[model samples]
Target: MSEIKKIHMGPAKCAVDLGDGSERGEYVNQDYILNKLGRPHRAVSLMYCYYPLDETWPARARNAFKDKEITFQWDYPYDDYFTYKGGIGGTTDDEPFTCMRDVRRHGQDVILTMTIDPNVTDEHLEQIGKELSTFGRMQLRINHEATGNWFSFTKRATYQQVADFYIHAREVIKKFAPNVQTILCIGGVEHPEKGGEIEMEKEFADAVRATDIWSVDKYMALHWGWPFDVADEGGNSFGRSKVADTYNLTKLSEKRYRELCGGVKKPMVMSEFNADGDVTGPYEQAEMVKEFCDMLKNDKDQGWFNGFTFYQFRDRGRLGLEIEDPNNADCGIEQPVMQTYKEIIHDEYFYPEMKSEGDAQFPVKLRWGGSEDAEGIEIPLHFEKNPTFCEITFEDEDADLNLMMEINGKWFYKAPHAKTIDFMSAFFEKPLESEADMTLKIFAPPASGENVNDGSEDWMLNTYSTITKMPNIRIRFAPILK
Candidate 1:
């Protein structure tokens, strides 16, 4: 007998991502999610390149990303390209907002991120505040990774200067957008000595007061092509070629955050995270995904921690879950990490919106029959009444468990195929006619050759008998009583 372990399904949490928005029609595919995966993400994140605030730039941003569903907008407007009124004005690669009309119409909230300039004028801050006031709410993040040397703000602006700017921006935005919140995004504590040796409290004394949420950006880059030290960039450490041996990236980040920014007790999130495919293959990346989620759930400060935003949806330079192919816009090849991520976020913990409110429980038992070699079982859903909503939760020891439902003489296979499944739900517009006739089957994970899609159900036809152990399962149903 194997040890019975319970998978803790935590409370509702936010799970977000940055999808591909390279072109108009080249956005992330919804058809694949609806028809294939049968799920929708909680929120979507978009990226906007550097652009100074010209009169027309806001209109371009509004036109490009007017979708009310966008939860976060990443931007890179720096001191070099920005001024009080307007600097070098042209079209940015992408913009978060173009006009305030769409924002007013939808009353939608935006998670806006951008770098602050040391030379920014009060007029510039006022313009930004005024623009944000027209929206439902805003989470404005200024000068992310101020401790990192990549951005000009790190070198040009002192910590006090950055903090002063942050406080000023918050005050200006609050006057107009009362519902707006400010976020203080920092690079991970791992490289705290990157830009300077100053402590966060003394340096960011004023900025901490203005911040509503705290965020950090971390990545698994030790074993990647990156050298241990920035001074050794041209060294032979380029081909470390192995996935990181440690699974405590999240744990380390949280610990370091508490050590450095412990005084500021605010909500924290991993604003950006990923294991580069260029650094590690899909399998290793998939492993890291699970590890990171586990650490977030078990180790981090749950009260102060919210959730994370994955860097990219499709493979873009070194990051992304799905393989990027410009020719195939629908959805590129599913990297192993893609399916792994889909399954992990499918948990109700990530999508609290899907959590059911009903208290009905439908007893189900796996009926094992036939010869001792039988690989499948007929699970009978002994429902006393018709159900308006039904969901099944089960824990499989291996990835070999496959589930199917027979409705109206047709069979539907639950997706995230061949992967270990945690739970699945079914909702009917109308009450079920007869619960006795409805049946479900479980079989060994299918083992078909690659590129063997015949466009028919013949591929799913399997008849092997190897009954080993009874799977741990739970069922819940909300029935409509006439």
Candidate 2:
């Protein structure tokens, strides 16, 4: 394990919410955490540790991050929802300003998840606006997990009430923190009871309809703590979320969330995901993580998921899927799961360049050409080493391009297969012929009607170009080894 541990000395890579959201400096210790695992946390989420998401004590909180990104989440002392009271913190309203000021000095981005009760006063809303204005470019998720019954805002409020609150929050946050990224988040899907005041699916759908950037808290496990129906009905099962050895991505998935968002098109993240309670030995745990990560990596609707953070870094009671080497004899520095994670963090797709130091980047350059150049879409590709797979993305998906890529001699196809690619992205996993130069040809109906079976080919060719001028392409090389 010591030999395998890799150093994570890059910008924040987002592994958050460890151990009941406390501010104790235990997990924040870098040298100690590095010894236990291969690297330090790219992101650490501290939930409700400070009443106002306090970042005032830089000397104290800064060390925990060790220069990593910070995600601070907490419920405001807003007594907006008054039916059943939870311990609402006092007006630590000034805390965010203090905390964010310290975070800016840390030189990393921050994600702030703030919750307000139903009885939220105008003063409280105004304070939040000021905080965002002060914080600047943070990802602010208001009343996250709005679909769940746990939080005060969501528990008693009707779905309409939650939706209205979310709309208002977004408006307020934007008015102040023009640079802030407002996010809509929900607890994992739930069975919307018949005749219930809240319709989890409809409410979530409505919320995302208001904004494109959304977050969800989902765990891939054998016995899910929540209804499998939410997943089943939504027609989305992100890999092992259907439990071990099952994946039905088409019907229910992150796509369903995307579908609901309607038009706002920012990439989203699985703010909380992992095998939270899946009982597993070391190898099984490794497989679980590997499978799920692979699914996200290869998702045809690739852009829909920008990134994912394991449910937690340390542990919170029985839901403990701590990334750290554990105290139990069954877990150790030799744990296979940790090894898998170390390898995963090394992947460029996950950490990119500035986020991790796992591997040096292979240089890539692109030359521009008119849309009608060459056969289909002219794609030049080369992979000189192992793990040659890459993710191909487009800025527009308005056309039906049965895009096919010819690598070496064989061909690979992207989705929606023969159907239109409604989403703007897809994965390219064509195997490189053992380091030989590789070229990928992505074509809409061939410009030359030579391959056109009928007028449909000519029509399709003309149609794609007209749908949108050749769209922009973005590809991410896989950072991990095969």
Top candidate by TM-score: 1
In lDDT terms, which candidate is top?
A: 1
Per-candidate local distance difference test? 0.45, 0.42
Lowest lDDT sum, 10 consecutive residues, model 2, at 1-10
TM-score of each: 0.54, 0.50
Deviation in Å, model 2, residue 346 alpha carbon = 1.3
lDDT of 1 at 196: 29
**Residue-wise C-alpha lDDT for candidate 1, range 1-482, written one tens digit per residue:** 12222111123465443333321223354334333333433333433323343333433343544553332122222222222222233222223443111111111124555665556566666666655543333466677766555564665567677777777767875775554577777544443336422336566645654578767765654223222223134554323222232233433444545545555556666666677655556677778777767665664445556767666666534466666566765546667877777667766556423112222122222211111111333443555455544444344443343333222222234332344332333433234465544344442222211112245432222122233444444444554466
Residues 194-295 of candidate 2: C-alpha lDDT, one tens digit per residue: 322223666556666776466666666532322222323334332244533223322144456655555456555666555633344446667777887777
In model 1, what lDDT does residue 83 have? 22
Q: How many backbone clashes does candidate 2 have?
A: 15
